[model samples]
Target: MTEKTIFPTRLKNNDYKFTVWAPKARSVRLLAESPKLEITMNKEEFGYWSLIVSGIDAGTRYRYELDGNNSFPDPASLSQPDGVHEASEVIDIHDFEWTDDEWVNIPLDRMIQYELHTGTFSAEGTFEGVIARLDYLKNLGVNTIELLPVAQFSGFRNWGYDGVYPFAVHDGYGGAKELMKLVNTCHQKGIAVILDVVYNHFGPEGNYVSNFGDYFSGKYSTPWGEPLNFDDTNSDEVKNYFLQNALMWCRDFHIDGLRLDAVHAIYDFSAEHIMKQLAGKLDELSQQTEKPYYLIAESNLNDVRYISSHSKGGYGLNGQWSDDFHHAIHALATNETRGYYEDFGTPEQLSKAIKQAFVFDGLYSKYRKKTYGNSTKNNSGEQFVIFSQNHDQVGNRKHGERLISLSSFEMAKLVAGCMFVSPNVPMLFMGEEYGERNPFYYFVSHLDEELNRLVNEGRKEEFKTFFDDKGEAVNPASEEAFERSKLSWGIQKNPEYQSMYNYYKKLIELRKNHPVLQVPDKDKLTITENGKGFTLHRWQGDRQILAFMNFDQNDTELEVPFNQSGNMDKILDSTSTNWNGKGETSPQKIIAGETIKVAKEAILIYSN
Candidate 1:
């Protein structure tokens, strides 16, 4: 059902009917500190306490005081202007003046996503700060911007995953109104926003879901905490709690898409898995609103069924983050083979990733000590989201060093070439475009001192297990980590940063303009090793483009099967000099079986 059927369609006079499914409470009163008012509840047959407060306008601070004590944020609060400990605030979605109506949803197949954390994407660390950079994103040719979760967490600084109130906007990064403004501005610039949501666990401090009912199950456990009760006796209500939360973002907040966090950890043995239910609901909602909706899963399971459409007997998600692809690329670029990397790291593995989404598809994993991952052979490349680096891959590291720090500039350019030219949807972590040097260390803040100590000790212990060297461990709870992660906006003005930025823009533009890049035909993508480098081929109908890469330290001769070309034109090159040492050139042609010298760490794009 659309918004027209549920609640007052127009929301006339700015008044609202507030209701929540809190049955055990003796008394429930609406506590709006400013413009103070009280509301009494009417008990229903199901014991739900509800009350309608008239003249309840938007931007009004409010909360519920149970039995005249023990106040908490509203379960359905549209905004938490204060932190999670404080009262919630009422917000009118229609009150905001939105500027975008002509924006068409960017198809998932064509999406070149740029992921950013609001607090770190800019120096200001606010929604308004990001709005100033819309033209930068548009010029970079990105169609979708995936944000880390913006739900209200406890402290002023957080990664935003441990959010307690799924309905409320994070006050630290500008309240709900400003968030809506950010989305509105992004849409106006023809960019879609995809929010990353965590449903598996809640934060430590203000988590109050258990107060209502048996929302968590002791039967199962996650690495973070207790597993959500999705298959227990009261599983119906527990499921509804999360489902409604998802709907609230899409329906009330007008979010375009969601990236489901770690679905593999969501233990559900029900007849209808939570993912299936979510997919079905999103499908219905999309049809109701006549807007394109998408679901992307972050699963280490490597199960292609997670993305398969429901009609085709799969989960029906639009796409999923391919960690296999990330791991292979990251290992090759940095050569860090700890933990899961013990199983994968080879030139062959990287080549396998070029054809298949995952390197270990149904292969025996030495790390897991079992066979893992499903084959992605039949799936289109668009079903996978590949990245050289992301928040987790960077922040979760020992020091949060980016590819620019770990590898040379030539390797950096080569990594970009692989990501942009590959068939899968490419995602650039924030600051990666300009090779920004800031580290994205994991940061958190806890109210309890013991908990803070435990987090720091645990971090050190985890790293000790992987790498024996022990240095000063980053205390996530401290103010320093958050400050360090913030991007330096001034980096864009530097000559080196500008050159790298322009290179990214050109790559993205080429990806968009070239049909061969979007061609999902698995047969069309072919990779062959020639000399010390690799030659990648993607056929666009009858025509073909060849991408040659030399990963060796010294310039090497590449045997070109020249009979495959009529006339050659250099489409793109990552070198300072041509085939000869004299001058700049595009595409150089040679004999049918002649050999050509390819510069070290260079990428050459040839069109025939």
Candidate 2:
């Protein structure tokens, strides 16, 4: 039988087949909390323990007792109603009535992802809260929303990366049923859902997976926690455990895609890599359902093997995040050359990132003190997902300052222009479209007081290189930090924020309507670095677009790159009065060989 049929706590007609892999246990017993029952499970091959219990319906709480001594919650639990340390609740995943049979996933290349945290995205801070804003996102022209991890964590407030139960949905977010409703409603609103999943390392608090079996590897170490045992002895069942988790979100909850978090940290040295196996499994699932399902990775190695084809000795993932693109734009916009930003902050670097996919393609870095990253010139732009700001970029800071709060409003518009005009898929952080000024701090509500203190100290130590002052950082364990991170929806009605929202809408409209902008072929794109700025010219046969980006603080004259007799019409100007800019500095019509005065901190788009 396949993993789907063999693994997971399955239920059929009031009968439950409870299965768990505990290689080190001498004996295992099931302790159903409600309706009170105790049964001994038979040990099978491959260290799996199983038993069949009748008359137990959905919502029954249970735990596993090992060696008639210690009891722990199910590792593959579907619901944790009270918390991670409490008993696991049995759920019928197929019980929900879904109406999205005809809804197909949008292609990865055409996605405009808007990432949000479930705890801070709305006032309700539940799955239902996100469903209430689906129409708002659709009207803003975002086709997809990438949610931070929603797996069961330690407490009610968290970023979701500290998830302990891979199969269980966070009880604070309304559990598995509410997540299904969110996905179904999003599809009905013509939006797709991409979930962020952490497979590299488990969180510190309430992690009991290592108690029953060899779930973690002492041979390797990660900054977050103990690395998963992927290449060690008895690794087959370990791989199956995570594989079934990925398929459960797709088969049970109907998620469109998953963004693998920090895959570079997932240590595996087997002959067949874990990522390759995951890609193959997802491909089979997509074929079986006749619906497209995508797997995107987050890696800073700048290696193409993560997104390349299997025939070429690659993992064959659909897409990966481009940190170099974000770094180049961010360093130029903010101009704070601290930490990793030391390697960026130049027009040439930005130009190279826009033309090629990676800025540090086998180049020596002053920060790392060695050469880093392989060239991505051969890869298509569709294989990359670019963003100006994300959860890590904002939350990792000492003060958690967003781009809007860290820079001027004009600079924010300028960066958005650069992102939308590029060939890669663009993503927006939540509240970015409306110029939201909230600080998305790293927060968690761990029950252990010692663990909370350690987290706060670790956060401060991590940012010592970024900030000159040694003052205390915002407390990640405080309730105030989590409350301040919530998005202020009422502020969008203000004049300044309303204008920023409209500007973003216009940029999305242009990207969708223009043929040249829609194409992701970087070969047809040319970027020329000028003084303090650059010129980007992309063409698809007769359809062409020329963008002038000025990052300097003063006006600069730049020569048009078109032919002597060619004429182009201006489509967008970030410095125009309509977008709450100083005024229009660039002309509406452009002739070849003519010099135009581009406003400082502005972006001008022209088409022919």
Candidate 3:
């Protein structure tokens, strides 16, 4: 089951060839617009119908009629021009000119990811609008920009997780041409693009896949509803539906990588799991293209098995998102211990997260009231994607409070310093570098009135543990909520905000060029704390670096000496007044027995 066997495929003469898997269809018809043609499609083995129409070339609007009665957009549509509820437009992916031949992505060890929602990232909220901010990201030293899903979700403004049409790019985002242009521009700017794709469920509106075939299962259910029928009868075609979408994004769209969203919700009980198959397909495609195609998973399960090699009976994914790092840092920095943060907030927990990607490895979980997680099995730092803040951490909150609103200026810098210095790959939420004041709230434009009401009510109920007293929830269905979430690019003009922005760039520069920070040996990275401060030591070949950080509001002294055989050289000092701090500049050196003094809520690094 390759390209033409399932999706829209064009012939050598440039005519259109369309194929769809409709297992339970009594009659299938290709109803095309422009000329108003209703051509009968021929049936094939395993319940597939296809038609080769000569006159209907690319950019033709079409839909399928079931039994000459019900009509729905193609499940594999490339572009929904009118809307998801309307007809799907035909698109020839080869028509677009791509200029990424000279673009080669940097290694994962040197990656600095920046996550952004295209809608709220700019006022225009289009793919072209993102191009205006590319220079800003490039100047900020970000080598990667991970976009929240851009697939054809209902309406214009969404966080994009509720995408119903998996194949089409949202028409509101300037459609396929503009999206490809954005991808090309990112590669040219030395920034790799990772698209966050959701396969667990579709949005509550305009989803018609289940009408044509047995696409859902009754055995296993997800938070959204019945999961995709992966282990059920007639599921082979359903599996191909999602599998083809993965190959299309990589081989067709030139996406450097994909961030598989909420993999925990993808319930599959089969001999060959969907993740393994998807990873295997991408691996094969990568070899053909001669460019690395990464498959990163967003599984909050904290199970390293998701990223482990398939040969060892694991999924063999390139990386998985690490919630432990954020939870540990948030608890320590903000002292919030009401919800999931109840299990975090100690130097030991943070130390464990730094040493191993998971803090609760087969340990007891107060959140679930049971034991949870397993050992990472000592996976490489590249296998774990760590971030101080991301979409879910910000947008899922009752108030959509970002780290800037939760921590102080110096604390924010310290958080950045520690993340960049760590061995794990680091990511930053959009507007975090520039200190954007606005929140990244969750907003959607579902066409169904009742569905939208339930979603808004459920969202408010979920955050009951966060607020001391519940107030009327900000209507997620409101246009104002979505408008307010847009990134405030104005903060870059303020001097203090500019300093914070520069500090982030400086940290990224150190991460890219510094030898000690480039080291991937997690075993060589050590953390120890006494009272309100901790010291982290890292070594790579002949290069060694030591960092002293104080978490207390008052100055804290490191008990151990930092002389390191009298070969130490000052590297980074977050306490300097240059960073808008009240602390003095760091000293050139410290004698063998002299204890290092660290300014409150700051970090200092030295190299040897």
Candidate 4:
């Protein structure tokens, strides 16, 4: 494969070159719906069919007729104006007028990510809607925004995991041009954009890629279905298709990074895994573009190979989501020991997560009934993206309760402090900074009634272990679920919500300004677990910071674990009266060996 992309329909000088990989088809014809022309395409090498027609340009709708009988949308459609089942529209990707020529990409280590779904982030439910709030995100101290997948799915409402056309932007989300505008506007505002992409399996509905070639394999199975054909026969083209799709986002759409969803489900057994190949190709592109592009993976396997260096016998991706950190904080706060949370819920686990970046490193998990995960002790904290709550952790529940609803406002603040002060990179879900009470329920809209029924039933079955017989799961197919998930921006005016928002803002500012906090080296940090709370001490040369977290129900006094040459001044106290806590209980200054009383469910920071 060359550096040039060969997936989308190429339009040049009033001529459109159509191409499709249909190895099994006896003959393929180009069906131009608008011009009403039927033309046979010449079969090229490697089972590709192509046809070049003049006097045609962008916005023309066309499809491929396989064996001169059945016709389906192009597998590499760039814009599905009429939906996934309709004809694929020709889109000139370079037609947009961009003003981000001087925009520089943010490094992965310094990124403060804010993930939001396009449909629920604003009332318009489109790329333009998100662009309207660029200033709001910038004010919140987020340098990067991670949009949930925008690839064309079945309908207007989806979690974006069900996308069928990887190359096309969703028509409901203002299509390709609007997406380009969003990226361009984000760059102009000094905010980087990372797109979540799904590649484990195509959505059950509106998936026609299999009809073109052997895009799936029956040998390996995922929760959705058979995995993509990565190592099967004739897998080279299949691999190229996805790789080029990734590059198209960077080269054409100017996506800063990608969050690969559930990569543990990607089954491959080749000498050079597809992930390594992708990392190599991305590195080459980064050099050519003179900009750093990151690839972050979402995996629950707790494997360090994804972020490890290639010379270390690993895949060498930029980063991966650290579920152990989320689980540690969530289990401790909610105290709900069901499902995966059963393995967590202790200060010791939280300490391990903060210090080692993985709590289940080669340990036996009661939930899985086996030993899982490798040690990430050698990996830098920059390789992991830590969060207190995300879409899956909140929306997959029966009620989809946020942290404030599930626990308390103080606990929410405490968790936020823990996440920001830790060694790993931090991420915030939409509406979390202000303690939005709206439930982000798992919702979708599929045209097929049978598929919708199955989705509802499957959601119920999946949550049976987490809830008892009395708990009722929300119907994912209902319109109410999707409508209610939208963020209520009006709630930010409330005193309590405003306090929470300010607290998060302060934490982010501290993290950005402090050198000790900015460095993600675990070697310079120490964690000590008390009976009901823990203390974290991070130091670089002469500068040092100490965090005292109390998770108990009542105030408790604990001796300072570290020695101090002089009195340590207080920095941030979550229990301060300004943050709507009960009252300020911590002292203004801390001595070397004195025991200080810490308010329950609060976090205190001190520096010298």
Q: Which runs of model 4 end up more than 4 angstroms from their true locations? A: 1-4, 9-12, 554-562
lDDT of 3 by residue, 1-608 (tens): 33334668888987888998887898899999876899889998878898888887777899999988988999888988888899988888888888899876767777889999888888899988999989988988998989999989887778898888988898888888888999999998898989999888887778999878888888877887668887788877888888889888888888889999989988788888889988998989878888888889998788877788888889888998889999998888888888899899998888788888799889998987998899975688888889889999989887787887888888888888888877889999998886776877889888777777998888877878776375666789889779889887775478778878888888888888888787556888888886657788888888888888777755554455664675677777887767777766567766565677677788988887
Candidate 3 structure, TM-score to reference:
0.97
Across residues 359-445, which tens digit of lDDT does each residue of candidate 2 receive? 998999999999988978778998889999999999988888899888799999999999999999889999999898988999989
Q: List the residue pairs that clash in candidate 1.
A: 570-586, 570-587
Question: What local distance difference test score does each model get?
Answer: 0.77, 0.88, 0.84, 0.88
Provide the global lDDT of candidate 3 against the true structure.
0.84
Error of 4 at 237 (Å): 0.6
TM-score of each: 0.93, 0.98, 0.97, 0.98
Q: Which scores higher on TM-score, 1 or 2?
A: 2
Candidate number with the higher lDDT (3 or 4) = 4
Off by more than 4 A, model 3:
1-5, 468-470, 554-560
Could you tell me how far off, in angstroms, the CA of residue 461 lies in candidate 4 after the best superposition? 1.1
Candidate 4 on 191-241: residue-level lDDT in tens? 999999987899988899888899998898988877999898877778888
Comparing candidate 2 with candidate 3, which one achieves the higher TM-score? Answer: 2
Better of 1 and 3 by TM-score: 3
